[model samples]
Target: MQAVLNAISDPTRRAALALLQGGEECCVCELMTRLNASQSRMSRHMKMLQDAGLVIGRRDAKWVRYRRNRDLAPEFAAVIDAVLAAERPLEEDMA
Candidate 1:
């Protein structure tokens, strides 16, 4: 519960998760663009999510793409799904 709460506490992290909900893995550059944040800022939020076991990142040819860490915690998945479902106008995903 604490992990899930902490993971969603930051709007940046929530936006990152929202972007990832589109079913496409996102590279750091893409996230930096989409989130309109500095590389360091994005990386820092990503690290928080990674530490929370909410996201997984993998390197590919100099790019690091991130996606929801499905294998780490099923409970976290349910929590994310529920929150997203209850939230209206899931529009931040486009940004």
Candidate 2:
């Protein structure tokens, strides 16, 4: 889907997806810390992922935790899997 393409187009968002694909909900603050991003920056990135249906966030007390939407269409799911498998090298370089 076009939304899936748009969602994974950003390196940061793809990294976020990599984290979320691990099957645990991650806090927005934690994502910002890992990404070295400001709160607003993380929020904006997350909003894009959310709109694309690649992720979903829920209020958890003061923080919103996000995780990948396993309900994604099969085509999109395949893309997420590909990103996870293919982008590890890039993540290591970023580190």
Candidate 3:
């Protein structure tokens, strides 16, 4: 879909989703630290992914944790897999 492609066209956003492909939740802080990004910037990127329906977020205390959306068309899942496969190894999660 155009939305998915638009959301993922940015490398940073793609990397964020790739990190989440493992089916585990990660805090916004964790993603910020791992990606070497600031809070506002990471938040904006997360919003884009959320808009695309690729991920979901939950608020816990002072943090927001995000995880991949479980419901997806098979085609979208394949696209995610393809991106993960094409991208290089991810940086360690430093948060």
Candidate 4:
């Protein structure tokens, strides 16, 4: 799917999604630290995730938290899940 491809096209976005898959909704600050990405760059990636309907972000005062869109396309989610599953390094790094 175009949306799925777009969402995972960037390593940054993939890393973000991979991180999100592990946590209970995370804020921008947390994501920045985990991904070691600049604010602007992370924001752009978040925008793409939102546009793809793969993630949903909500504002909480100064924090903007993001989580996977549970209702998103199953096929797309499956693809991301598969990739994230295959990247054992990503999982190990999270621990």
lDDT of 3 at 3: 95
Error of 2 at 71 (Å): 0.9
Most accurate candidate by TM-score: 2
Instruction: Please provide, for model 2 over 1-95, each residue's C-alpha lDDT reduced to its tens digit, 9 standing for 90 to 100.
Output: 88788878998898888888879789989999998888998899999999999899999999999998988888889978987788887768989
TM-score for each predicted model, relative to the true structure: 0.83, 0.89, 0.88, 0.85
Off by over 4 Å in 3: 89-95
Tell me the lDDT of model 4 at 69.
88
Model 4, 38: alpha-carbon shift in Å? Answer: 0.6
Report the alpha-carbon TM-score of model 4 versus the true structure.
0.85
Candidate 3 lDDT tens digits, 1-95: 99999998998898899889999898878999999999999999999999899999989998889999999788998998887776654433433
For each candidate, C-alpha RMSD in Å? 2.9, 1.6, 3.9, 2.7
lDDT agreement with native, every candidate: 0.83, 0.88, 0.88, 0.85
After superposition, the stretches of candidate 4 with alpha carbons farther than 4 Å from their true spots are 89-95
lDDT score for candidate 3 against the true structure: 0.88
72: Cα error in model 2, Å: 0.9
Q: What TM-score should be assigned to candidate 2?
A: 0.89
What TM-score, to 2 decimals, does candidate 3 have? 0.88
Name the candidate, 1 or 3, with the larger TM-score value. Answer: 3
Tell me how far the alpha carbon of residue 22 in candidate 2 is from the true structure, in angstroms, after superposition. Answer: 1.2
